[model samples]
Target: MDKKAKALELYLEGFKVVEIAKELGVSQPAVTKMLKQFPEYHQEKERRKKENQEKARQWRNEYKKQKREQYDEDYELVLKSHREDAAALSRRGKLSDDILIKLCILNYDYNKEKERLVFNESAGKRPADLPRSVYVHKNVLKQFRIPTRQ
Candidate 1:
């Protein structure tokens, strides 16, 4: 094939100009000059780039959709298991109203601690807009090396 045809073919196959030059036994500048003589090759390259970008966008959207669905399913399963465990404890006379209240308080404290840990680890700073009562749990604050305000 001629230089132009060979260059176009190599470009369509994802070869860089340098690689095409090596394959065609021409200098890089000469290969560039020849390719520039054909505007259609540049157009084809742009079209391929746009098509690849669209394909990547679609793949990312599909992946995020799949992940969101999976997260929803897993969250539902966890909620159901927690409800079942609570019910089982109630049936065995192990769960009382006061105990349930305490459990809720503990759950709130655990979640706050987890949020603080994640925020501190990521940002290396204290969280903003938090009320004093939120950080009243001394143990959690101590773990993060945050001094408690009196």
Candidate 2:
């Protein structure tokens, strides 16, 4: 076949004008001129452009879906780790089942804060009629983003 047929074939196969020029050992303007001579050139180019754009959009959507799934998996792992830590505390008699259940709904930050509050209170803070667990429950509700409340 002639250069025109070869150029048209390469163009349909998604090769750029510069690439086609290099492949055919011709100048860029020569390749462009040859491609322009075809009656269907503009329409074919537009169709391929739209097709590539759609493929890119689909790829992006799939990437976002995968990232969302990965995030959910990571979130579950974190919750499981927290539950194990709470269970360890319960087994050691450091936490009651009721308090452990409440703390289970909260993240690590709340647990750390609750521990600090308990330490500060035990180290000679002002006395109160309410128990420490009650204060911790109130703090957990007020401070953290509890899923149940949503």
Candidate 3:
């Protein structure tokens, strides 16, 4: 068959423009120009684009679902540790309902903060709301004999 026919076939079979160009031993623009001659070319390309977008959307949704499951598992582990700490405090006669509620809040806050930090770090961006350095009084560090950041 002719180059146009072969190019059309490859394009309909979902081959990339560059691949079709290589197969036909022609430049990419030439292959594109040839494909443009056909009425169905743009239609097929748009269909493929939409199909790829749908696939990407599904992948992102699955990734978010997995992350949610992992978050749940991690939160459960944190709660278990908090419960153990509360039990220990109770054994020492220091646990209170108010303190237990505070522990749960702390656990929730810690997990959320940790998730935010991890996401920011992975995305190669710093959290805009977080300070780069904490402001600690020099006198307190000196009293504790702890090294201070300049």
Candidate 4:
């Protein structure tokens, strides 16, 4: 094969210009010069790079979608189980104030952790219509070392 054709082939196979040059028994600059002689080679390489990037982005979006669906399904199951347990305790007359308080604290901690994750993922952009009072409440909770709910 001609040097240009060989270089193009190697380049398409994800070889660096230096490697292509070495394989073709030419200098790196010579390889670059040969590639420059064919503008179509550069165009095709760019097109392939974009195509690969688009495929990766699509895959990432699909993965996120699947994860969200799974999370929603699991969350619903857990919520139902929690409600059933609460109802059973209430029917047996075992749901005391202490138990209720503990449950409240557990729910609060779970919500706070979820909020922190969301805040971090949003890069610190506050949600719309968030009350100023809630910010003050959070500061107060922080001062008291009490975790706030999401």
Candidate 5:
């Protein structure tokens, strides 16, 4: 590389401009002019940045593809196992239909509680004065439901 380019790279690599000028044994203004006059360094920097971005994009795509493949394989295995377990439980008569229904109800309740926790956390400090009936949906609509007395 040219002395000017080498000096410029050194300066860009964190050496002070004055130090680079002193090392190159050129006047400070001369070094500055040399750096400014060369467009190759700027082009190289832009090219490196673009290359890094492309590499990052490729890495992300590969990661997403691998994750999706693993997810599908795990999903298939889980669904297969779940169906097999449900069938075995059914044939064994281990769970009364009533107990199974209660288990399902418990699961639904757990999920609702978890979702409510996330919703509340995202909403920050909820105003105590806000009505209990209000809800925000994925479609960006506000829903207000009135409670019916049993």
Candidate 6:
């Protein structure tokens, strides 16, 4: 359960001491103690870990120094490309009447779908002999979360 034991296990498994020290977030001197307790070749792995950490820190600093205008230009390019795509879809007659009908019901983003209203068949006050067809719209039925056996 201790970090020293884990470092020892990792060393025996041929992981570089630099990797062990980096993973355990400990100094080489401390790692040497864990290595001595386990008595394996963990020394080199620790040195490599410090180098890896320095490289990682360098990348993080560079990322933080990135400019806001770089992101703004990316947004402008994406907006221009999307406008062209919409115009193309419109020109090709891809946005037809039937497609528009389905799109308005399903693709109107937020206000698109119907709400569920319960009307159970078995416990109904309706007539005894009824048709077996699905009466509600498929989208409306989905709102009820009903389990259909058929």
Q: Candidate 5, clashing residue pairs?
A: none
Residues 1-150, candidate 1: write the lDDT tens digits.
788988978887788889999999999999888888788778877888898999999999999999999999999999999998878687767664444433334323323443332222332433243221232344534443545489
> Candidate 4 has which clashing residue pairs, if any?
none
Query: Which model scores highest in TM-score?
Result: 3
**Candidate with more favorable, higher TM-score: 1 or 5:** 1
- From the highest lDDT down, the ranking of the candidates is 2, 3, 1, 4, 5, 6
User: What residue runs in model 3 are displaced by over 4 Å at the alpha carbon?
Assistant: 95-150
Poorly placed runs, candidate 2 (over 4 Å) = 1-6, 13-15, 85-150
Q: What RMSD does each model have against the real structure?
A: 13.9, 13.3, 16.4, 16.3, 16.9, 16.2
lDDT for every model?
A: 0.67, 0.70, 0.69, 0.65, 0.60, 0.60
Per-residue error for 129 in candidate 3, Å, reads 38
Q: Per-prediction TM-score, please?
A: 0.48, 0.49, 0.59, 0.46, 0.40, 0.26
Output the worst ten-in-a-row residue range by lDDT, candidate 3: 108-117
Candidate 6 C-alpha lDDT tens digits along 106-142:
3222222333233344544433222222234556535
**Model 5, which residues run further than 4 Å from truth?**
5-36, 89-150
lDDT score, candidate 4:
0.65
- Encode model 4's per-residue lDDT on 40-149: one tens digit a residue: 67787798889899999999999999999999999999999999887868766766444443343322221243222112223344434332111123333453344547
What local lDDT score does residue 97 receive in model 5, on the 0 to 100 scale? 43
| Reference-based lDDT, residue 15, model 3 | 92
Report clashes for each candidate as comma-separated counts: 0, 0, 0, 0, 0, 6
Instruction: Give the least accurate 10-residue stretch of model 2, judged by summed lDDT.
Output: 114-123
* Best model number under lDDT: 2
- Across residues 1-150, which tens digit of lDDT does each residue of candidate 3 receive? 999999999999989999999998999999999999998899998999999999999999999999999999999999999998878687658655344434332222112222221222443454443332233333432332334489
